[model samples]
Target chain A: MAKTVHPDQRYLLALLNNDAQLINEIYKKCAGKVKSFVCFNNGDANDAEDIFQEALVDVYNQAKYKGLELTCPFEPFLLLVCKRKWLNELKKRAVLPVTKEEDSLLHIGEDTFEQAEQLEKQQEQSKLFLKAFEKLGERCQEIIRWSLKGEAQEKVAEALGVTYGYLRKKKSECMASLMKLVQLNK
Target chain B: MAEDKITWTARFVEGDLSEAEMAEFEAQLQTDAELQQHLENYRQLQQNLRQQLAPDAVREALQQTLGKLNSQYFGHETQVLSLKPIIKWASGIAAVLAIGLFIWAPWRGNLYQQYHVPGQMLVAERGAASETELDKAASFYNDGKYAEAKSILEKLYSKDSQNAQLSYYYAQTLLATGRVEQGRELLTTVYNGESAFKYDAAYAIAMSYLKTGQKTECKSWLQKIAKGTTHYQKATDLIQKL
Candidate 1:
């Protein structure tokens, strides 16, 4: 059975579905409070906009990677995410970091906030995985990349001037090798 | 053994295993802890790589999506924050709604909706206007103090039982309070009697029927008012709506 979708989570689905109209609604309805929070905390409109976009991307990635399920209203969840991202930005820029939040945002339950942290952790993993991928051998990187892109094994072998059986074998070895490198990097 | 493990893990991740092989792979996954860990790590690597290695087109789309959000939040908001433009647009819509209500009001279907701006009654009788009970009732009615006006009108109505203005305005009070039956009876009496409010009373009765969800009776009463009468135009519009 299809799960009953919450209204707030509709924004996340819009991001996933690439529905421009509904995504536009997310900006129209929810960005005002976020802009207020950002501007009040020594940031400008540009900063707020950047934080909001990043928050949205984080939500999208969480839904894609961490199976993020929204359990509260979208506005507060979005506000919490934007606030956290802005504080992280502030910390990155060497500004005095914010520990407190607007009472409205803080009132949402712990898991939603934890979801934001989880997405950030996933983001860190992606960054690490990319760096480790670059350290891999050329054939290992190409095989992994092509396999992900859904390029046929026979076609990849043809392009690399190798047999299909050898390509699969090399691809497997590369996956195992890539995991080892990622583990070592961590 | 290591090469065999690597090959099977890759095929399993890629769904390159056939039915028998996939069944065997599932059985091994259920029992073999080390192979399960390898599969889990490979899956995680696949997820991270798929995300980080997003195609150039997908990356551009993501940027464009963010740009769309940026323009909506900041660009439009900056214009709205100017206050003058927002005020201008707001007052413009208000003015347009006012003109719209004035020019094309009667076609509004609901009786309560149709009766938004009350009819012009209760003319000031020279110097007797302000201090008189009639003026007090008019003032109360105009100010939306319906219950107060109804009390004053009912007392005034008992004194002058045949007064057209008294009957009409008092019945309007009843209608406003959702007492459609009482309002309809008073309207019918004024409509039948010789009074200046005869046409108006007919129209009010029609309005009362509409308020009571009796459109058919409302239409019949509305159709009786003559063309040159004060309420003929409104009545005609209401009949068409019915």
Candidate 2:
């Protein structure tokens, strides 16, 4: 089903385009809630700040890479992502009995919850892919990186001192190798 | 899997196969679960790689901007805000004396000066020649060397006439250097664009009016900044004072 693109997709666009004023609006309107949640939990203002920034970065990455579409208001969506992130942080720190906050009980929609889960999954897959990528030979890594940078294959080939045919053949082989490595790791 | 088969599968996932070969491959893939798995993995790799490896100047720019905002929101400014009521509760005699001193205070300077928070020019190309020149321009502009900043910005703006961010900073340099008409005109263009700078440009126009002591015009521009924008509070405050 084609989900209606929420008006708050503007916030996602702002993240992608690095629109400072709109981004500032995100902080101004949303940061207080995030700070309150973090402080009420086993966290501080600095912890909240870090979690907020990281969540925004995750949103940006999803928008840039996966074409993340927001179907809910950005505030609740952002708060949801921040809550999940803060919970994870608590788990990592082994903090016990997190205090309940009213803000954390935000009435988010099912679609928004699914969207946050998808973003988290995509981010985790990206980390695994990166881990596998680092295991590739330097030549394989270089070829794959250049090929995937949205440059023309011919231009990339020329820049890399290879013919178009050779670059294509090498790129295919490198990708094949990467897939095998990824499958093995999985 | 055979070496040739793996390469062929990878190439197919990459869309490197010709129309005839792709048609042939797709027909075979319906019954071939192993081929389907290989194809899925290759496709996933490409998507992940593209996402992971793409050059992200916007992300870098966003990080820098967030750092600055964090300081303002969570820094000493919060403490300063907490102290405001204390100032209001001072005795009437002390308040009168404070107002008398404030009338002569440099801190209570120009309205425009008090509120004109300049947007930092965060051009994302970190090490390019244009980026270096822009950094220099930003430095000069921040240091109040508007004339020097204006020269470099003018050259850049001419080359990239459609770059809204460049146009924004260029407009700021113009306004700073007393090129009021030219500055406001450029800012109008930014305000009309579909970027995040639209409200910022509006706020800049208001500041320019305040600079010229045009209170009515200033308030009108400030009114254009709707609620929920970063500038809305400042705009409303300015409007009330005006």
Candidate 3:
């Protein structure tokens, strides 16, 4: 069954549209809780701010790419995402013992957790892909970046000063190299 | 042959193949698991690349907007004022005026005494039964009988520890009675809660540190009170004296 999109998905659209007012509303309603939660969890305001910002960026990427639809309210969902990100950071830092947060018991539904986890996984893949892209030769990077820019292959080829047939062949080769690098990185 | 297969998979994923070639590729893909995996990886790569590399003015704009909002929302907690230049300038002027005027104009008395101005507890509108007891606690707090105030507030806090206002005043009473660690713990909890008492708790924590003559820690906490908060000016004033 298709889940009904929650009304709060407007926040995601706001991110896509750069709607400053709605984004401000998001900060006003949600940032405090995230800051509070991070501060309570052996993190400070700076850590909370970084985690919150990164979570918003991840959500933007997910909505931009995967056409993410919210099946849950945005606030709790955003909080859960930020909370998980901070916990991951805490684990990485290893400066403090990661205690089981009381709010981890918050019942936001399994779908929300699934959504947050999916975004995290996609973000991890993006990181891997980006690192691999960086390791590719400059020509390959240029071809791949241009070809993926939603332009016609012919126009991309023209922009890159290459023939259409060459652009297609070389883009595939570059992508294949990229895929191999990503596999190696993983 | 291997490179040809990879190229065909990418072309199939990107819709670059003609109908006849696509048909042939799909037919081969059904039986060839390696080709199927190659197709899947290319498809995933295409999606990821489009998402990652596509020119997104909105994404840039959103990032800029989020940077502004992050400052507005979480900026105050770590925004320490750079006092070195100002202090250097002040000392320069003090040397030029060298006629018995001190740079520390605000250092008239004990730093804690000058800055530890706790707000009155006025949580009476919560309920009738609690109102009388809270008002009594408020009276004791106002009269400087923090022990009496703590006795009542402690009892109330035990029932509703999540209440920011209660935790704040209880923390104040604990600080007043010299239970600095216990008081700071409560204040930290209040500071960590999403209540209006957050900066107030920070100010109280600063005052607690100041009372114990911990100037560095006090100034550190004081600097956490960003501009525009009720305690910002007072915290800065004390920071200057310190």
Looking at model 1 chain B, report the run of 10 residues with the lowest lDDT sum. B121-130
**After TM-score superposition, what is the CA distance of residue A37 in candidate 3 from its true location, in Å?**
1.5
lDDT of 3 at A99: 60
Sort by lDDT, best first: what order? 3, 2, 1
The sequence of per-residue lDDT tens digits that candidate 1 reaches over residues B184-222 is 667877998778889888877876777667888888998
CA deviation > 4 Å runs, candidate 2: A100-105, B1-6, B14-23, B30-37, B76-242
Interface RMSD of each: 13.8, 7.3, 8.0
Q: State TM-scores per candidate.
A: 0.53, 0.56, 0.57
Q: Once superposed on the true structure, which residue ranges of model 1 sit more than 4 Å away at CA? A: A1-5, A98-106, B2-8, B11-27, B56-62, B76-242
lDDT against the true structure, per candidate, is 0.73, 0.78, 0.79
Residue-level lDDT of model 2, residues A1-186, one tens digit each, is 788999999999999999999999999988888898888887878778878888998899899877899998898889988888898879877996366633536787888888888888888888888888877876777788777767898999987889898887788878888877777887
Clashing residue pair totals per candidate (backbone < 3 A): 0, 0, 0
Number of the top candidate by DockQ?
Answer: 3
Between 1 and 3, whose lDDT is larger?
Answer: 3
Leading candidate by TM-score: 3
